[model samples]
Target: MSVSNPTLITFVIYIAAMVLIGFMAYRSTNNLSDYILGGRSLGSVVTALSAGASDMSGWLLMGLPGAIYMSGLSESWIAIGLIIGAYLNWLFVAGRLRVQTEHNGDALTLPDYFSSRFEDKSGLLRIISAVVILVFFTIYCASGIVAGARLFESTFGMSYETALWAGAAATIAYTFVGGFLAVSWTDTVQATLMIFALLLTPIIVLLATGGVDTTFLAIEAQDPSNFDMLKNTTFIGIISLMGWGLGYFGQPHILARFMAADSVKSIANARRISMTWMILCLGGTVAVGFFGIAYFSANPDLAGPVTENHERVFIELAKILFNPWIAGVLLSAILAAVMSTLSCQLLVCSSALTEDFYKTFLRKTASQVELVWVGRAMVLLVALVAIALASNPENRVLGLVSYAWAGFGAAFGPVVLISVIWKDMTRNGALAGILVGAITVIVWKHFEVLGLYEIIPGFIFASLAIYIVSKLGAPTAGMLSRFAAAEADFRLNK
Candidate 1:
C-alpha cells in the first residue's frame, strides 16, 4: 500500500508543533523544579487535559477498542473501573498530594516525597522507590513505543524496526529539550485531538451503518453472545476487569499531574474537566470498537485487519470510512495518544533518576543547570531501554500496559493513600509496603498464580504489609509530630 501524502503531511505538521512547544518550554525553564514540575504553574485546563492525555495513552485509541471488539461489553468493565478509580483518585488524592508534596520537604519526586514524609535518614525509601519507578516505567514506556510502532506500521507500511525508532524519536527529542512544560503543553493539544478523533469516528460510523438499531443488529447477527456482558465470564474475570480502576491511584505519571497543578484549588476544576473528558472519550472509544464489530460483520472482505490484530480495528475503520485527508487526521490522533503518554513516562523516569537518584546520591552539590541536563540525558537513556523492549513487533499494547499498571498500582497505591490520610503510618510500614507490593506484583506475574489480575493480589498484600509492619515497628516521635502537623495543615488549607 502506498503512503497517503495528506496523512503524512498532517503528521509532520503535528510533530513539528510539538517540537516547537518543546523549544519554548526549554527557553522558560531555569531550574530543576521548572524542568521537572513546570514550576507548579499549570492551571485547571492544562492540568486536566495533560493528566487525561498522559493517563489514557494509546490504550484509549487502540487497546480499549481492541478489547471491546474481541470481547464485547464484558471488556467494558475496565472502562467503568477506570472511570470510578480516576474520579476517586482526583477527589481524594489530588488536593492532598498537591499540598503535601510542596509542604513535605519540598519533595520533587514520589520517592523524594516518601523519604521526606517519613523522615527516612538512611535514604532507603528513595533508593527502593526509585528502583521500582525505573523498572516499571521502562516496561510502561515500552508499551507506548509499541503502540506508536503499530501506528507507523499500519499507516506508513514501514518495517517494524524503522517504525519503532521513528515513533520514539520525536517523543525523546521534545521531552529531552522541554522537560515537564513541553510534555504538559503537548498533552493538552493531544488530548483535544484524541477526543475529537474519538467523537467523530463513531458518529460517522453510525451514519454510514444506518443507525444505532442496525448497528446493534449487525453485531448481534455476527455472534449473539457478543451482546452479553457476562458471556462465559467468571467472577474472577469481572473482578480482574474492574481491578484496572485501582491502578489509577498509584500511577506515577498521573500523580505527577497532581503535583504539578498550580494550587489545590485548581485541582477541583481540573477534576471536573478531566472527568467529563474521560467519560465522553471512553464512550467514544467503546463506540469505535462496537462500530467496528458492526462494520466488519456487514463487510467481511475488510475484516483482515480485525482478524489479524484486533487492536487495528480503529486504524482500519479510520482508513476505510474516511478520505485520505480526514483519515490522516484520525490516524494522527493515535500518534498523539502514543506520544502524549510516552513523553510523560519518560519525564517521570528522568525525574526519578535526577531528583531521587542523581542529585540525592551522586551529586548533592550539582547546579540547577547541571541537574536539568542530567535529567535530559536520563530521558534519552530511558527511551533507549524502552525501545529495546518494544523492538518485538508482536508485543501487544494492552498486555504490556496492564503489567506496568499493576506494578505501580500494587506497589504505591495503598502507601500513597494511607500516608496522606493516616498520621500513625510508620516509615518501617511504608518501606515494608513498597517491598511487598513490588515483590507481589513480580511474583504474581511470574507464576501466573491466581488467574486474577496481579494488581488485586499485589495491592491486598501490600496494604496488609504496611498495616502489619507498622503495628510491629517503632515510630519516631518527631515523625509522628510532623505527620500530625502536615495532616492538619492540609485539612486547614483545603
Candidate 2:
C-alpha cells in the first residue's frame, strides 16, 4: 500500500522533532560522561519512561503481539515473565547499581563497572565484557533495524533494502549528534507515543469487533484453543517462556538508565512508574493480539497482510481501523519504538568501545571533547554494522532479540547481581561467571538442548561459577572496603 499523505506527513514531522531534540541535547553534552551517561542527571520520570521504552523496544509491539496472534494466549507467558523480571530488577538492582557504579570509579558502562567492581588491574574483565556487549548488541541493534525496515516496507511499499536504510536513518542521526541525552529525551516522547498507540489501538479493535464479549465469542468460534492459555504448552515450554525474566538483570541499555539516574533516591519512584507503564503496555499488547483474532476473523477479506506476516498485526490494524490522520499518529508509534531502543543500543555499543576500549587502551590521555566525538563516531560505525546484519529481509525481530537478550542476561546478569549484593564474589569468580554464562548460552543455543531456553542454563551455570570460584579465593581487603562503602551509601539513600 502506498503511504497516505497524512501518514507521510506524520512520519516527516516525527522524524524532524526527534532530530531537533538531538540538537537541543547537543548543547548540554560537553564531556565523555555527559555524552555517554547524560552526566548522571536524569529525573525519575525520564529515567522510568526511558528505561521502559528502551526495554520494550520493537518486540513489545511487533514480536509479542505477533506471537499471541499466531499461538493464542499461551504466548502471554513471555509478557508475564518480563513483568516479573523487570520488577525484581528495579527492586534489587536499580538503586544498588546507581550507588555502586558511582562509588566504583564513577563507571560509565557495564564493562567499566565490572572492571572497577572487581579491581581488574589486568583489564581482562573490561575487554571480555566489552567484546560480549559488542557481539550481542550488534545483533540486538539489528533486531531494531529489522523492525524499522518492516514498518517502512509494509507502510510505504518500499523494497526491503530501501526500507532498511530509510528506517535506520533518523535513529542514527539523533544518536550520532546528541548521544545519551538525546536518546533518553527522545525515549520519553517515544514511550508516550507507544503507550498511546498500544492502549488506543486495542480499544478501537475491541469496539470495531463489537465488544469484549463479542470479541471473545468470535475468538472462541474461530478456535477454542484461543482461550486456552496452557494449550499445547509443556512444562519446559512454560519455563522457557518465563525464563525471559532473567534477562532483565543483564540488559545494558536498561541498566544504563539506572546508572544514569540523578540519584539512588530516585529509584523507588522510578520503579513504581516504570512498572505501572510496563504492565499497562504489556496488557495493551496482549489485548491487541487477542482482539485482533476476532477483528480479522470477522473480516477475513482484510486479513491478507497479517496472514502473511503475523508480526504486522498491529501495523495492519492501525492502518485499517483508524482514520488516515489518527492512523498516521498511531503508526508513528512503531517508529518511536524502533528508534528509542535502537538509539540506546547504539549508544551502549559506542560507550563500550569509547570508554572501555579507546580511552583505556588506545589513548589514556584522550580529552573529554575528543572522547565525546569518538563516541559519536562509534555510534555511526555500529549503525553501519547493524544495518549490514539486518540486510536480510528474512530476519525475524523476535528471533534476533531473543538471542541477544539471552546473550546479555546470561553473560552479565549473574555477574552484575552478584557483584553488587555479595562482597565475597572475587574477581576470578566474576570472570568465571561471565565466561560460563556466555559460553553456556552460545553452546546451548547452538545445540537446542532440551528445548529449554539458553538463558535458563546460562544463568544457572554462571551463578554457580561465581559461587564456586569465589569460594576458592576471597576478595582483597580493598575490594571489601569499596563494597562496604557502596553498601553504606545505598543504605543512606534507601
Candidate 3:
C-alpha cells in the first residue's frame, strides 16, 4: 500500500533496458545509412511504433497530463487535434515520401530530398533548409532534454542540472552509436514499454480508487470543470491549444521515418498501427492524469505538495496510488517518454548535420563510415548545447515544444506541402516561406496576441506568398510538366 523497494527495482530495470537496447543497436551498426535510416528496411511494426513513440514523446506524458490537471477536460481537445492531424499526415505524407525518396535515388535526409526532388540549380535551398532544421530542432531537442532532467528531479530528487547532462549523455551515446536504425529499434522497444506503463498505471489507479465509473463520478463531483470538455478557455484559445496538430506536416523526425520505411506498401499498415497506438497511449496518459485528481481529492492526507501544481501529477500519482513495485514501473514509463523523445530528436539533429549538410555539400565522396563519425560527433556537440540550455528544466513541456514546433511548422510546413503538390514552387519561394515562417514564430512568441497560434498565421502567410510568387516565376518546360503531373496526381488520388 505504500512506497516499496520493488518500485525502485522496477525503475532500475527499465533504465537498464534502455541502456541495453542502445548497446545492442551499437554493435550491429555498420555505417551511416544503416545508422540513420536502418538502410531503408524498417518493417511496418518497427516504423509504426517508433514513429508513434517519437511523436508522442514527453509532450504526451508530461504536457498532456499537466494540461488536463491544470485545465481539466479542456486539454483533451489537443489530443483530438493531434489524432486528426497524425492520421492525415500518415495517409498523405507517408506513402508518397517513401516512394518519392526512393525514387530520388534513395535520398537520405529531408534536406537531401528537398534538394534532389526539385533539382534546383542553386544549393541555397539545401543550405537554408539545413540551417532551419538545426535552429528549430536545437530548441526542440533542448525541450526534450528539459523533460529528461525533470524526470529525475521530480521522481528521484536529483538536481535539475545534473539530470540534464546525464539524460542527454545517455541518449546521445546510444543515438550516435546505433544511428537511425538503432534509434527506431530502441524507439520501438521504449515505445512499447511506455505504452504498457501508460495503460497499466491508469487501469491500476482506477481499480484501486474503485471501478471506472466510480473514478469518473469522483472526478466530476470534485469539480464540474473536470468533466467539462471546454472548461476554462475561449473558442480561439481552445483552437490554438489544439492547433498543435498542424505542426505534424513539417516535423523532420516524423517524416524521416516515412523516408526510411521498407516500402510504400507498408505505409497503410504503418498508418493503421501508429494511429491506433497513439490514441490508446495518449488517451491512457490523459486518463491517468485525470484519475490522479480523483484519487488525490478523495485522500487529501497523502496528497503532499503535488496536488497544488499539476506539473507533478504523474510523479505524485506514481508515489501515492501504487506499491513501490508498480510505482517503479510507472516511473520507468515516465522515463520511457522522456528518453525515447530525447534520443529521437538528438539523432535527427545529428542526421541533419551529417546527411544534409556535410555529405551533400562538403564531401560528395565521403564514405558512410566518415559520415557516421560526423553524426556521432554532432550528437555529442548538440547534446552538450541542450544540457547547457536546460537550466530551468521545469518549464512547461507543451510551451517549450510549441515554440520550436511552431517554428518548424510555419517555416517548412508550407514549402513542404506546396513542393509536393505544386511543382512550380520555386527556390525563391521556398526560401521565402522558410524565412517568413521562422521570423513569424519568433515574433509571435515574443509578442503574444489573440487568435490561433503563430504557426497558423505563419502557415497561411507562407502558403499564400509561395503560391503567388511561384506563379510569377518563369518555369522551365520540365518544371511545368512536373506541375501538371502534381495536379494530375492530386485529381486522380482524390
Q: Pick the candidate with the highest lDDT.
A: 2
lDDT by residue for model 3 (234-309), tens: 8988788777778888898888888888877678888989998999988897887889878888888867756555
Model 2 gets an lDDT of 0.95
User: lDDT tens string, model 2, 1-494?
Assistant: 59678988889899999999999999999999999999999999999999999998898889999999999999999999999999999999999999999989999999999998889999999999999999999999999999999999999899999999999999999999999999999999999999999999999999999998999999999999988989889999999999999999999999999999999889999999999999999999999999999999999999999999999999999999998888888889999999999999999999999999999999999999999999999999999999999999899999999999999999999999988899999999999999999999999999999999999999999999999999999889888999999999999987
Mark the regions of model 2 whose C-alpha exceeds 4 Å error after superposition.
none
How should the candidates be ordered by lDDT, best one leading?
Answer: 2, 1, 3
What ranges in model 3 sit over 4 Å off? 1-5, 474-494
Better of 1 and 2 by TM-score: 2
Estimate TM-scores for all models.
Answer: 0.98, 0.99, 0.93
Once model 1 is optimally superposed onto the true structure by TM-score, how far is the C-alpha of residue 104 displaced, in angstroms? 1.1
Model 3, position 333, has a per-residue lDDT of 72
TM-score of 2: 0.99
- Which candidate wins on TM-score? 2
Count clashes in each candidate, considering only residues at least 3 apart in sequence or on different chains. Answer: 0, 0, 4
lDDT of each: 0.92, 0.95, 0.78
Q: How much is 241 displaced in model 2, in angstroms?
A: 0.6
Instruction: State candidate 1's TM-score.
Output: 0.98
- Winner of 1 and 2 under lDDT: 2
